[model samples]
Structure formats: structure tokens, C-alpha cells
Target: MEMNILIERLQALMAKGGRQILGIAGPPGSAKSTIARGLAESMGRAAVVVPMDGFHLANDELVRLGRRDRKGAPDTFDIAGYRALLDRLREGGPEVVYAPRFDRETETAVAGAIPVGPDVRLVITEGNYLLLDTPGWADIRSRLDEAWFLDLGAEARQARLVARRVRHGDTADAAAEWVRTVDEPNARLIAPSADRADVVIRLDA
Candidate 1:
């Protein structure tokens, strides 16, 4: 979708008053973060981007759970904590709401990273499982005022995933292998959730 059009749509949604939570869900490498950040930038202080990756389990915890190899899978996150935060964000309050952020370089979640104020009219939270309908994930959809699913061709998505892995220190071959073994399965799981989104956005490279 054109960025200008999306901005206008979100602006219209914000015009209704009260706090609005906008969710952008997609498979890895679908530019969820990029789009969410762009929207927040366009809206300025009126909006804040709170990413779901911040709910990722610590690497040590993942290893203990034997889920290190599939870190981005559904069960690898703190779903309860994510849900609680969403509840609080939806409720709105007088004080600043601090949200965690995931650092790709460290592959760790830094607590109290992003601050969302009560005055903020829009909260853009993007991630892989926003529209997922499993036990823990099902609660997220209702919290969003509007849910958007980003759709990208598998070839382009996989290429971007591989490039991202390489940029994060994996060798080219290792990156490709990881994308095939880990990301592809997750992508398959995420694709169906697009049906739950209010709108599906076809994205270009």
C-alpha cells in the first residue's frame, strides 16, 4: 500500500478520539518494524511504536526450554506479559507506559525502553503473532483497534530474511540454512493469520 494513503487512514482512525492501537502483523522480513517506525515518525509524538519482539524469552531461558533453535516460534515469547502490557496500553493511564525493546545485535530484550504517554493517540505494535489465534495469542487481536497484515512474496521475504541474518553476523550459507529451517516454518504459521487482519497490505521490496 502507498505510505501516504496508510498515513491518512491511520490519521482518520485517530480522529475518532481516545487511544487507538494499530497492529501490523507479518512473517519475518516483511518490514513490520520499518513500516511501524515510519508510521510513528510521520505521526510524531502522537504515536509510539511498541514492538512485540520485546516479549521474546531470554536466550538462556530459550536454551533451558530447549527452544533456542526455534527462538522466533510462537511459544518462545512471554505471551502473558505481552498480553498484560497490551491491556495496560489499551486502558490508558496518566503516567508514562514503558515498553521493552528487542536489540537485534544483542538478541535480547531491554526492559523499559520505549515510553508511551497517555496523550499519545496511536500505538503501533508490530510483530509476527499479533493476529495468531492460538491460546495465548488469541487475546491480542481484540486489543487492536485495527489490524494490518503485511504480505510479501515468499522469494523476496526469504531473501530479505537471509540478508538480515547475514547482517547480524551469520555466514551467508548459515543465514540461508537458518532461514530455511527456522524462519520458513514460522512464516507458514504466520501466513494464515492474515485472514484475521482488518486489512492485508501487499508490500514491495
Candidate 2:
């Protein structure tokens, strides 16, 4: 769908005059953050993005659990915490609600980094597992007013993933290997959840 049309749709939803949550779900490197940020920018103060990446487990915790290598996998996040934030966003109180944000530079979650005030009408949350039916993740879909799955060709998506890792300081060979052994498996797990989304969108590169 065109970005303009999606913006219009979100505007219409916001017109109802209560907080609305929109979830954008897709595999790694599907540009979910980009799209969510674009929508929030277009909407100005009425919208705020609270990304699921912020729920990522600390690197220390991942290492302790022996899951550091598969850091982006399903179990690598604090799903309960993520869900609790969604609940608060959905409830909409008088006070400001602060949300965590993931810092790629340090690879850690920065607490209370993004604030969602009471006046914000829409909360756009994007992540890989929003539509997953797994134990902790299945509750996510029900919290959103709408859910969108971003789709991209596997080869193109994988290439982007590799490039991202390299840009983040991984050697080219290490990035390629990580994409093969780690990201690809997560992508496969995520693909099936697309069927659960309210809309599957394929935006142009």
C-alpha cells in the first residue's frame, strides 16, 4: 500500500478520539522501524512509535542464558514487559507513559527513552513477533487496533540483514554467516505469522 493511503487510514482510526494501537510485524530487516517512524512523523504529535526492539533482553542476560548467538530469536525479549506496556497504552491514563528504546550502538535497552503522553492518539508498535501464536507472543495481536505485516522478498530481505550487521561492525563474512545460521531461522518462524495480520503490506524499496 502507498504510504499516503496508510496514513489516511490511520488518521481515520484516530478520528474516533481514543488511543489506538497499530502493530507492524515482519521478519528482521523488513523495515518495520522505518515505516513506523515515517507514520509517526507524518502524524506529528498525535502519534508516537514504541518499538518492540526496546523489549530486547540485555546482552548480559542473553549471555547468561547461553542465547547470545541467537539474540534476535523469539526468546530473546522480555515478552511480559512488552505486553504490560501495551496494556498501559491501551488503557490511556492522565499521566505520561515512558517506553524503552533499543540502542543499536550499545546493543542495550534504554529505559524510559520515549514518552507517550495522554494527548497522543495513536501508538505505533513494530516488531517481528507481534503476530506470533507462541505462548507469550499470541496475546500481542489482540492488543492492537490494527496489525500490518511488512513483506519483502527473502533474498532481498536477507541481503539487507547482512548489510545491516556489517554496518553495525560485524565483518562481512561474520554477517553473512549470522544471517544464514540465525536470522534465516527467525525469518521462517516469522513468515507464517503474516497470515494473522490484518493487512500484509509490501512497500517499495
Candidate 3:
């Protein structure tokens, strides 16, 4: 989608809305967070971001479950908590709703970090599993007013994932290995969920 067209569509949605929730779903390296954050930034105080990353299971919990190696997988997240929070956002009651935020350096989620005010019409959420057809994720589609999927090519997506891992302090070799062994499988699962989105955005175009 062209930048102007995307912004205009969002503006129109805001104009017609009582409460509007936008979900951006895609593979790990597809830049879902980037686009969602950009939209909220452009909309200023009228929009707020409530990222799915904030639902990540703490590292110790993952260790106890023996799933630490597969940290980014769908099952590793607190899907139930995420869904309940989305429900609250959809129902709209609190004068200020507190949501969690993920800390990359610590690789954990901080509770009550994002304060979403009642006046905000748009709640922008981006995550890998928003459009997934799995049992736990199915109801997410019903809660969203609109959902967008970022479609990026395989080569570019892997490259971006590798770069992100390195920037987050992973060694080059470790990043490549994790992308190959872990991220790729998750990406394959996520790619098919694009069909469930209201819009499939081709970022490379």
C-alpha cells in the first residue's frame, strides 16, 4: 500500500469509529511492529500501541517448561492473558487501561507499562499470531476492527531477522543458527495466516 493511501484509510477508520482496534500480523521479520508504531505515531495522541510482545512468557518460566530454546514460538506466549486484555480493550471501560511492554534487553515483559487512555479511538496491536487460525488465537480476529499482514520476501525477511538478533547482542553465527533452526519454522506457520487479514501489505513494493 502507498504511504498516503494507508494513512488516509486509517484516518477514515478513526473518523467513523467509536472504538477501533487495528491488528498488524505477519512473520517474525516482516516489520509488523514498525508499521503499527508508525501509524500510531502519525495519529499522535488519538492512537496507542498495545504490542503482543508484552505477552511473552518470562525466561524463567520458559526454562521451567523446557521451552526456552523456542522462545518466539506461539505457544511460548501468554495467549490467554493477551486475549483477555484485547477483550478489555474491545469492551472499553477504564479511564486508563494499563498494558504490558516487552523489554528486549532483559527478554521479559513489564506489567502496567503502557497506559492507553479512554479517549484514544485506535488501538494498534502487532504480533505474529493475531491472524493464526489456531484455537487459542481464533477469537482475536473477532475483536479487531481491521487486521493487516506485512508480506515480505523470504530472503529479505531472514536478513532482517539476522540483523535484529545481532543488534540485540547475539553473535553473528548464533543469530544465523537461530534464524535457521527456530525463526524459519515459525515464519512458515505465520505466512499462511496472511490470508485471514483484511489487508495484505507488500512492504517490498
Quote model 2's TM-score: 0.95
Error of 2 at 48 (Å): 0.5
Backbone clash count, each prediction separately:
0, 0, 0
TM-score of every prediction relative to native: 0.97, 0.95, 0.95
State the lDDT of candidate 3 residue by residue for 31-124, as single tens digits. Answer: 8887888888998898999999999999899999999989989889999999999988888876788999999888889999999888878999
Question: Candidate 2 residues 4-104, lDDT tens each?
Answer: 88888787778777889999999988889988999999989989999999999998999999999788899999999999999999889898999999998
Whole-structure CA lDDT of model 3: 0.89
Candidate 2, which ten residues in sequence have the lowest lDDT sum? 9-18
For model 1, the stretches where C-alpha displacement exceeds 4 angstroms are: none
Q: What are the lDDT scores of the predictions, listed in order?
A: 0.93, 0.92, 0.89
Model 3 regions more than 4 Å off: none
The lDDT, on a scale of 0 to 1, for candidate 2 is 0.92
Candidate 2 vs candidate 3, lDDT winner: 2
Instruction: List, residue by residue over 15-38, the lDDT tens digit for candidate 1.
Output: 888899999999998999999999
